[model samples]
Target: MHRLAPLVFPAAGTRHTATVIFAHGLGDSGHGWAAFVENWRRRQRLDEVKFVLPHAPEIPITVNMGYKMPGWYDIAALGLSAGQLRENEDEAGLLESREYFQKLVQQEIDSGISADRIVLGGYSQGGAVALFTGLTSLVKLAGIVGMSTYLPLSLKLESTYIPKPASANVNAQTPIIMCHGTADPVLPYQLASMSRDHLVKLGYPVEWKEYAGMPHTVLPEELDDVEDFLRKVLPPSADGKTEL
Candidate 1:
């Protein structure tokens, strides 16, 4: 398997206290979201958090008339409605992405960052991959942030993996942050809501938020929400506060 190179952002301090691997959406590369994180770091002041943005391999997408583009996996088709007869789910591509994603997480672990201090996040299709990988991860992660995306390969995953039921301390170890727009046309707002409901049923501790009349993209408000999520999931500072 070919390993994708990443755009690495080192922590500002002498040592990194946490590591975050955030993937990009279809047709996008690591450079796309680099600005978002730079803005986020500037606003949130998380100098102790190292960021990694991995470039998705360019592949022919069957749904887009087989045109090649940078994507976590090949999109078979778009699912605007849950009742659609055909869902373009690239199972093989999803599995391939999962393997690469695990390797990225492993690299962080080998670099001295504990599994619990590592976060996996993505937007759109990338978010779907992150959601799939994080849930099935052997090494528990600090958290997962998914925006404008839904759970991918849910049916196949259900057939293969049975998640643990949420107990007394459901999200005590690993939590989730999911946000979507109600007016999204590409992925559909209702579709994201359905995904959120499904995750809850599967015993995932998800903090789901909805934006009214928003489209299929991230907004300033959404970034603010993610910033708050980072503070909660990332490790605390020396003064016992999650300041950054």
Candidate 2:
């Protein structure tokens, strides 16, 4: 299994009830999301939530001129060819990435947070991984937050990997939030809609949000929405009224 170096952020308070595993976009490390948590701490004064960011191993993206960068998969082309951009499916790297992610989750569980109290989220390619891991895992988590990412080919609703809605082992009812920018050039906004439709068909409760006139990047309002969703899905306190 591939090893990942993760940055962990423990809640400022004495007790932590929730954990947010943050994954970064393509070519970015887990440290990329550090600023978001820093800002969150200052603004909300939330000290009871833990954050973990894991870095993806360096890999080559065929579509990006075979440049070696931090990528979850290799895209062979810039155009929309079906199999051209999906060379990562046959590679062992993605499976390794999944194992690395699983280890990260286990590390969190070892730290005292229950698996049910964990929320997984990410941006772009990282978001795709988070969604893939959250849904396919046997463990049911608190929620999943996918920002500017499309569902992975492995879990493509049209493929043979259809998830059983009535299965007692799967968390078919897990809440998922997908946020996309209408003008995102990297991953088209339509993919987000398709993902939402697919999840709904699979009986997963998903919240889809499109930011009009936004680009292929995270906006302040988008982060706010993520924060709010996290708070609602993973309440920091038992009373559920804790600010931030």
Candidate 3:
């Protein structure tokens, strides 16, 4: 499979501390989240944190009128039935994306950043992929952010390729920040709650936020919330301070 081009934002200053890799939603590319990060870099002066945005390969969404969009998996229908969504869930695609994420993580690790300094996040379908990859991957990360997405019900968390005790402990130690607009039309707010419930039930610590009256797209306030979450999860370097 062809790898999608990744939009990389290298840490401005000399010492790199953390890397945040973002995945875009259906019909979107890595550029979708660039504006937010650009604004954040300016406001927070995040000169030591590297940011990466990887585009998903364009594939036909079997359910969206055969619309060929950037997606990791296909949705058989716009109106998702619990069973169909669970059954038709693309396990292979999920694994493939996980491998791709692992490659990115390894690249960062090879570049001198530790595994614990990495963060993964995304929106909508991208959010789903982030959660899936973050939870299943063997390496422990600093955090995982999911915006307007739900947990993948297809694979049992226990059946993940990574070992259980270590993976569970790592996930528990790694903070998960999930933000959802109350009025989100694409992925309902309830789904976000459902995801939280599921993760919590599985003994994972999660920080969830619900924005009032916001639409499917992210708002400025939400972006601020994300920054705050990132700060809390992936703190600054050991000099006792961070720029952003």
Name the weakest run of 10 consecutive residues (lDDT summed) in model 3: 160-169
Candidate achieving higher lDDT, 2 or 3: 3
Deviation (Å) of 52 in candidate 3: 0.4
Q: Which should have the higher lDDT, number 1 or number 2? A: 1
- Of 1 and 3, the candidate ahead on lDDT is 1
Give candidate 3 regions above 4 Å deviation.
160-162, 166-169, 239-244
What are the TM-scores, per candidate, against the unseen true structure?
0.89, 0.87, 0.91
Could you give the candidate ranking by TM-score, starting with the highest? 3, 1, 2
Give me the overall lDDT of model 2.
0.75
The per-prediction CA RMSD against the true structure, in angstroms, equals 3.4, 3.5, 2.8
Clashing pairs in 2: 11-47, 12-47, 63-75
In the range 153-225, model 3's lDDT, one tens digit per residue, is 5347656443566535566667898998888777777767877887887777898888899878888887888
Please name the candidate that would achieve the greatest lDDT relative to the true structure.
Answer: 1
Number of colliding residue pairs in model 2: 3
Residue 229 in model 2: shift from native, Å?
0.5
Any idea what lDDT model 1 has? 0.81
